[model samples]
Target: MVFSWRKRKPRNGDKKVHHMELEIPRHFICPIALDLMKDPVTISSGMTYDRESIEKWLEEGNFTCPVTNQVLTNFDQIPNHSLRKMIQDWCVENRSHGVERIPTPRIPVSSAEVSEVLFSVTDSKRRLDRCECLNSVHKIKKWGLESERNRRCIVANDAAGVLAAAFDAFASDSVEKNANVLEEILYVMNWMFPLAEAQLLLGSKPSLRCMVWFLKSNDISVKQNSINVLKELTSCDQLYGERLAAIDGVIGILFKFIKDPISPLITKASLMVIYHMVSSPNEKTKAELVEMGLVSLLLESIIESEKSYCERALGVIDKLCETKQGRESAYDNALAMPVLVKKILRVSELATEYSVLAIWKLSKYEEKVLIEALQVGAFQKLLLLIQVGCSGETKEKATELLKLLNPYRPGLECIDSQDFKNIKRSF
Candidate 1:
């Protein structure tokens, strides 16, 4: 017989708590949580615990059984339905004591089921049905959101390439007809990250076209996701970065977002894409970004940004400074030296490092910029950075900068940041 239990609410005049003081059976409690086991499951260690609790433990990279500390050889979780039913029966038997029945949990999605869903998405695309495709894509996103395990399964099943194909196919379709599907495609693709294999799939001219098309999307989410995917791809391989930089007008679109300012998230994503694109060995990529007034926008970002945004903007500037045109543009900006100097030792180690690099590169060859660096107190901060702590490369750059700026120093003695009374210039 199927049984159900519901706690009875007490009348106002009863003045008694309905369910606070009842004693739950020892076996019914989850060992992990020290509470009633709502959805009991047995693991390979021959221990039964609440499903959510055990899954959380495993998800945190634990391989040993929580109770006995035995190493788990098999991670499968078999539902203790019989025990669950018994718990329900006990609840039903104690309804007058205000025990509530445990609800039966739905079975989690299996890998085979994920494959079937992926196949359905492909089949739906072949049949040219928008509703079916959207539904299937949504299913994958749902499972991906359900748990980390499902996301791992989605990644294992090549969801990145499949989703990219779907996105490419639907990118040119009427936005009203395929907008939701495209967004879902990007959403699901996000779950399958470190997309090394998908990088090849998305590196083609057609994929670039799709990304450009998505960037034109009126929906902020579509634009955000599109840029985020590009960031991931360019990060995976510098070859991908070179390919993306080769696309005409792509750099301009990314800069437009920075110039006009979208949300902070999209703005940072766009900066990272620029960082990766210019990070390629190709100097022309960095040159193209500078040609589009990238230096001015990055300076603005640094002056008005929070710590995270400040770090990204400085990183891009540092990359750009590696090129001649980029260095020229930065030297031309009056705010350049002051802003870069101000960021030192203030934002983060990375921010300070990038700031120092930009200063070092820009002032490396120019006497006027070296003086400007000294006037902005760059010399003092560089010394402080070297003494306190920094990456070896940053320390090296700071030391070189100090040597370069020392002759320009008003006196051989340092007075701004620290005592140089006993210090000797190795240079």
Candidate 2:
């Protein structure tokens, strides 16, 4: 121990040190598991320590990194077993409470499945029976997935099957029982499936026969439903011409309905169908309409029928007058102009309004028909109507006719001077 000059370890209480010194720990001593100071608690001395900081550290886990936070990327966080048990309990409770869970079936069955189930069975009676079965099944559960499956099935399967289902539903004695089902079927036919197949199905002999049966039915609702189906069928652009041709005497049949006092709605709808049939400027169809005495029938309906029927009949005539062929066909038919003119003179004010519209349409072929109107005192009657009986539009039309009849100067003078002044004043 020869007095080696090793640096002396300083005592805690030593006062001879010249420079001040401090120490810092090389690593953080906080527990990684808690991610914060443990056992932290406010103390009387305004200092806190381990056990309290640890509890706070654990609670801090409830919060997280402000940006990254506690987020689950996979389903593991959901605890599937726990969720499944919860759902199962809920289902049990609902069932115990007698609440019915509606199953939603997708539309259209697979084509192959539809064919196998619907088409492979050859008997028409069996086909209809199968459709009824499918419809019943669909009704009970109301499965959206199954409905979609059936729709797909119909599209893929036999075209005849789809048509058969449609026809059966339409022609069923209990349409009230099947109306909703039939509507769904029509939706698939009209909007989901290819139009060509729908047209073929609609135009098929069996389908048409079913529709005809419905048309002849005693139930008014059933008859109207059939007409609506036919209307939708004919509404397709591709089927229009062929369906018109195929439904032979459709116009005649409709005309018969027009005479039926019990079927005014049917008659009106039938006329609308006829309007569409004739709307294409088809000369042959126009001639057929004329041949069937449609112009006379429409004019009579406009003049003599109740308000609803008259309005619809007027619409038919309005459509007829849209094309040159329709106009000429209407004018050349001798019964048309005279009947319309007589109606104009005879009907009430409102009826006169429609009658004047008909007259205006007829007057468009003035070069061919005006002189005949003049001979029938149509010019004088219109002049008198303008002066006293008609409204503003009728007067304007009457004035237009007078202008056209300028060659007949005597008839032109029949327009009252006072009426002209009133018309000019109104203008």
| lDDT on C-alpha atoms for all candidate structures | 0.81, 0.52
Off by over 4 Å in 2: 1-209, 235-238, 318-361, 364-368, 371-403, 412-427
lDDT tens per residue, model 1, 21-140: 667788888898888888899999999999889989998999999999999999999999999999999888886666677777767778898899889887877766778999998888
What's model 2's overall lDDT? 0.52
The count of residue-pair clashes in candidate 1 stands at 0
Return the TM-score for candidate 1, rounded to 2 decimals: 0.80
How many residue pairs clash in all the candidates, one count each? 0, 37
Question: What TM-score do all the candidates reach, one by one?
Answer: 0.80, 0.44
Q: Model 2: which ten-residue window has the lowest total lDDT?
A: 72-81
Q: For model 2, what is the alpha-carbon lDDT of residue 225?
A: 66
